[model samples]
Target: MNTSLLPTRHWLLAAFLLLATPALWSCNSQTTLQKQLSEHQDQLKQIDDDTIQSYLRRNNLLTKATKTNSGLYVVNLVDGAGAAVKTGNQVRMKYVGRFLSNGAHPASTGYPASYGDPRYPQGAIFDNSADNRTVCGCAVFTAGTGLTAGFGEGLLLSRVGDRKLLLVPSRLAYGPNGTTGIPTDAALMFDIEILEIL
Candidate 1:
């Protein structure tokens, strides 16, 4: 009941509340974001599954395409006669990447210095090797460098001269946070040809 202390007490209370506001807001924002992400992930998974199934049914590839344990769908278009690639082996490959939703290519011409091929036709091809004169040069990378879970796994399953199609879910591709040109939660399709393994 001290009149002098009342103003000081009120100021302290206001300071405490102001200091705690950001923390409270941050907690709520993080929780909401997490929930949204979880829902988005679930939705993307279902959409990817449906797209893959529909693609298989439409193309009569239901029996030809094999589903991996990690949810990737692989269809071997051509079985290679060369040696199979394994982890740590450097690989040279040509690929065309497309989004499963609308079958639009994400890789555009004139971005990466190595890319930008006139043969691809702008907005038609995503990524391709220069050998094909499509989009870019042949992709050279180690077998298991974790560049992309889906692509890496698919590559390991293929051999030199092998051509395969990979259906990659968002989780294995870019997840909810897709890169530029690739939409968030978008599924992807990759047509890859293994040129060499060194």
Candidate 2:
């Protein structure tokens, strides 16, 4: 039997049958979902951009504003409290960083918490877990230097025993893309107490 012997009407009917298959319907749904997903992502990007701008605009360290140069704001806190430090500088600090959107504090507690023991559960936030770290001790920013631009600027405004709150905009805190736990184009607030400068 020759396959070419198929009738034109039969071929037309076969084509129609394929065109109206359930798979085509599934494709339509997937296409619609993809379109919606694209639109949602675009909206999210716009929102993130807007949020960054709004935060930057509203940020005015006027009370502690010292200088502004190269897109960096230098704030000098009163009483030499939580001030800025330069890179490679050894400093002792008790810092607490919190997300503006949520009160989740992200700090490496430098200590370990006892797990599974009810008597003396970890006293501090930092537990013995491999992930938990304590940032309370003195840290020397060596080699390439350390801390974010905003944090570096913050040190300059601090004295050995000063304690001040640093309100860092995203541009000053983490820039356009922030670190983990911090959203993209986000504004960060830091409450730093300068224990001692070594």
Candidate 3:
């Protein structure tokens, strides 16, 4: 028996095993973490969907609400007869953007004017064109640009004077990285009245 080589071989085997163990364990740990994150996101999405559905049901808009391919819900509260608003058109709108607050919202406030009071039943008003109109004239932006993806899509579906309640899922708005006012995973509601295709 080559005793001298035997000990060296055993030592090498031990070193390799020690090195490989952590790599194997790390992959397993990463997988577990990924699974947990995916599950958490799924739960959040379910909660958001439920909240929107409940709001629609409460407002008797379930039948009228149409969900778009990207998961935007548009309820045409007041229909207008005119040419369909197109992308790149300058549109003037009166909009109140809020999150269908989950009761304990931090309460978004401060606008060109006083931000509307936020109560659980009323939801938090992040922005209101009604408040900003005097300061800037009801929001006049080129449609399909400089707006959230959901908002732009909703505009494309409207004509002049169409009053729409747009329920925008987080995925369509800000996704995981929310903007300054919108919270992560927060579903948004835009009560927008198309004033004109300017």
| Highest TM-score scorer | 1
RMSD of each: 7.7, 12.1, 7.1
Better of 1 and 3 by TM-score: 1
> Which residue pairs overlap in candidate 3's backbone?
none
Which regions of candidate 1 are displaced past 4 Å?
A: 1-6, 103-124, 131-137
lDDT of 2 at 131: 30
Q: Please tell me which model should have the higher TM-score, number 1 or number 2.
A: 1
Global local distance difference test of model 1: 0.75
Instruction: State the lDDT of candidate 3 residue by residue for 1-198, as single tens digits.
Output: 768899899999999999999999999999999998787566555555666788889889999999998788999899998778998999988899887632212222321112222332336788888787376448887888898898899999999879999998766777666777665656788998888876
Model 3 lDDT, residue 50, Cα: 65
**Predicted candidate 2 versus true structure: per-residue lDDT over 96-196, tens digit per residue:** 56443221112212111101223222112211112335455434332124667666677665666666555454456664355665544343445566666
Over 63-182, each residue of candidate 1 has an lDDT whose tens digit, in order, gives 999999999999999999998999999998888887665322223232111122233332354556665653546778799896679988898898998999998876888765677666
Model 2 scores a TM of 0.43
lDDT of each: 0.75, 0.48, 0.76
Clashes of 2: 25
Per-prediction TM-score to the true structure, in the order listed: 0.76, 0.43, 0.70
Answer with 2 or 3, whichever has the higher lDDT. Answer: 3
